[model samples]
Target chain A: MRNLFAFISGALFGAGLFISGMTDTAKVQGWLDVFGDWDPTLAFVMGGGILPMAVAWLLTKGRRPALGGEFPTPPAPKIGRNLVVGSVLFGMGWGLAGLCPGPSLASLSYGGFGHWLFVVAMLAGMMAAVPLRARLAEPAEA
Target chain B: MIEQDWIWGFVGGLLIGLGGAVYLLVNGRVMGASGIVGGLVDGSGMRTVWERVAFIAGVILAPIPIYPIYRTVETHITSNVAVIIAAGLLVGIGTRLANGCTSGHGVCGISRLSLRGITATVFYIGAGGITMVLFRHVLGVI
Candidate 1:
């Protein structure tokens, strides 16, 4: 039952990304291009996404353990190194190529070498982080 | 009145939010695309692999239905393969390190108004915007 629900939800999310034209890399790139022929399509998508999510957050607020399982821990409040540096790096990549993971998966059907290349390289990059994160977790040298 | 692109963006955004909200309401998960895929790849999410697989499957399956209705969603993705690959690598590492992306931080994180989410969003957007300015206007590499 839980898995089915998750599948359906994922489908909805995917559908939304496609219908919103988010699956189109050009559109994402256009939005990021801000100075030249800037497109506000992503802004609406952001607004459209935030409204209901805000409400959902409200409903789930008091439900510490959540309805189905123990709630995942909220991210720490402090502005940390990983968060800032990672975001900057992601921004550079997003600026370079508008393909983020969600759209990348959604647009796999489009099947261009570029998308495939990005996906594979992205996976490799994710893998590279495993040891990096492990190293970060180790105690600092004296 | 907004253009068709904006209208579709808003509607699509709503669906994305609905998808995310449903996942949270039922599964008590964040439904973040990067985190979902990244965790599994890194092997941390192995315990809950089925749910992640199911969710991703839905995302992949989404375009199948959407294609019938929204034929010809044009794309202007970069043809530069190296740029695409590098972007992919950066996004992969960045999201893992930063812990979120557009879907996770831009939508899910900002909606809840979590400090980390907001800060991360600012940095990524700022960096992306600046990168675009330099890349397009100054560097002209893009």
Candidate 2:
């Protein structure tokens, strides 16, 4: 049952990304081209997303949600190297491809070879990180 | 068609938020693509991998039924296969390292005013903006 609802939510979210300009690399690229022929479309998307989520947060404040579990809160660790470096790397990639995971996965249907290439590599990169993180975590390293 | 993109962007963003809210309300999970997918790959959230996989299935399949309606959903991603793969790899690894992406940190995290989420969002976006400037303006390769 939980899995079913998760799928439904993902479908809805995927539909949103598909309908929004997020699925189109051109739109995402254009939005990023702030010094060029910039497009403000994404700003609207961000605003639109924040409004409802804010409301939901407010409503669910001081209580566990309708699901009878705690909200998926952020981890409690302080800011560190991984967060900054990883995000910067992510930004560079976003600039390069103009597709994040949501749009990247959602748009796979129509993304053709180029998009598939990105997805496959993305998976490989993700899998690769597991061992890399372990290696870094090894006390012998530093 | 292009002029009204923000309108669709807004609507789609709303649906994304609504989907996220529904997921949280019913399943006690955040609809963060990177975290969901990354967790499965990195083997941290092993207990809920099935739920994450189900959501991924939804994201992958949701656009199919509506493909006819949004036939214009093609990607203009660059043809440099190496760059494409590299970008994907970076995004995959980076988002995992950072623990979120646009959906998780930008939408869900930021909406809830979580410090970590906001910090991650700012860093990634700032990095993206700088990357865009370098690639598009300074290098003229994009």
Candidate 3:
């Protein structure tokens, strides 16, 4: 049941990306162009997403877990260098490729050859993290 | 038609976020799209498998309803296939290293006001941006 719910949620997300012109690299690139031909459409799409998410968060606050299991909401972090650094990286990538991981996967269903490249590289990136993860953990222990 | 395209994307993203939140609320899950899909091949329980399949299916089929109102135009950006693949691999590695994707960290985690999530999300976004700047501006891939 949990898996089913997760799948449906992903589908909705992919569908959303497809409809929002997010999967279209040009649309994303347009947003990245700060000075020229600025397209604010992606902002609207993001805003649209935030609205519902905000409400959902409010409604679920202090509520017990609902799926007959515990939901561990991770602790918030202090605003620090990590936040600034990560956002910059994310924005740059989004600007360059016009395909974030989520949207990139959605583009695959449409059978775009380009999406295949993105997905394959994404998988490779994920695999590369294994060593990085071990290194990060080692520092914490030491 | 163009106007409608934007509308559909906005609305679709909104709905997907809402659906994902609700599913998470009801199912005691985080609604990480990639994890759900990944679980399908990992031999999770029947319920999980079904949900994962359904979510992916919905993603693929959801756009059908909106297709009539909007025609998508393919973007033309020239880059070597190998480069694109490398980028995707990097993203995949980043997600795993961070323990979540954008949706899981950016959307769901951020919504819950999680600090680690926020940190991880920052890393994901930052890494992406740096990669883009290097690829597009410095390296001139696109």
Candidate 4:
């Protein structure tokens, strides 16, 4: 039952990504190109997405999940180094490829060999992150 | 068709939000793509691997049936292998380090008014825009 809902939600998100032109690298690049011919469609998507989610967050308040698990607590408000550095790195990659994680996975079937290569590399990077993060955290701990 | 893209984008955004909402309200988990797959890559989510796989399966498979009807999926990603690899690595590592991606931070966090989410979104988008200017306009590499 839990898995079923997970699947359904994933499907919905996938469908939305496709319909929103997020699966298109050109569209994403255009949006990022604020100095160039800026595409404002992504803003609409962001705003539209936020509306329902804000309400959903509200609904989650003082409530447990309908399923048999505790709802995730809100993340602490602390602004850390990892957040800044990671975001900058992620943004650079996003600008270069115009493909974020969601679209990267969603576009696999239609995206061909090049997309496959990207996914493989992305996975390698993910694996490397565990050690990389530990090394990054070491200095703080010390 | 192009001029009215915002409409479709908004509609799609709603679906994406609804998906996130469902994932949170029912599954008691944040709908973060990179985190989900990252757990699989880093061996941290070994116990709940099936659930992660199920969600990913939905993301990958959902588009197939809907492709015929929607048909707006084109990712004009660069064919430069080096760029692709670099971008992929950056995205993978960056998302993991940050512990979130566009979906997790941008949508889920921002909707909840989490400062971390908003900060990540701003930095990423800002960095992406800068990268675009440097690469596309200034350097002309990508």
Give each model's clash number. 0, 0, 31, 0
Q: Give the Cα error of residue B79 in candidate 4, in Å.
A: 0.9
Candidate 1, residues A1-142: lDDT per residue as tens digits? 7778789889989999999989887788788887889999999999999998898888786784234676567875877677888899888888888778898888887747777788898898888877766555535549
TM-scores for the candidates: 0.94, 0.92, 0.77, 0.96
In model 1, the clashing pairs are: none
The reply for model 2, stretches above 4 Å from the true place, is A134-142
- The most accurate candidate by TM-score is 4
Write one digit per residue (lDDT tens) for candidate 2, span A6-101: 889999899988887798888887887888888888888877787888887776767786657787665774676677777888888888899899
What interface RMSD does candidate 1 have? 1.5
**DockQ ranking of the models:** 4, 1, 2, 3
Q: What are the interface RMSDs of all the models?
A: 1.5, 1.4, 3.5, 0.8
| lDDT: worst 10-residue window of model 1 chain A | A132-141
lDDT for each residue of candidate 3 in B1-142, tens digit (9 for 90 to 100): 4666567667866965776676667666666655554444333334566666666666666655655566764544346676566556555544554555656666776667677666765565455555555665687776
lDDT by residue for model 4 (B33-102), tens: 9988999999998887877888888888888887888855777989899999999999999999888999
Write the number of the candidate with greater DockQ, choosing between 1 and 2: 1
All models: lDDT?
0.85, 0.83, 0.61, 0.88
Per-residue lDDT of model 2, residues B31-80, tens digit only: 78998988887788799988898899999899899888764777789998
Candidate 1 lDDT, tens digit per residue, B1-142?
7699999999999999998898888888997899999988999899889999999999989888768678578556788888888889889988888888888988999998889889988888788788888877898877
Sort by TM-score, top down from the best: 4, 1, 2, 3
| Fnat of every candidate, listed in order | 0.83, 0.79, 0.49, 0.82
**Relative to the unseen true structure, what is the C-alpha lDDT of residue A9 in candidate 3, on a scale of 0 to 100?**
66
Report the error of model 4 at residue B6, Å: 0.6
Evaluate model 3: give its TM-score. 0.77
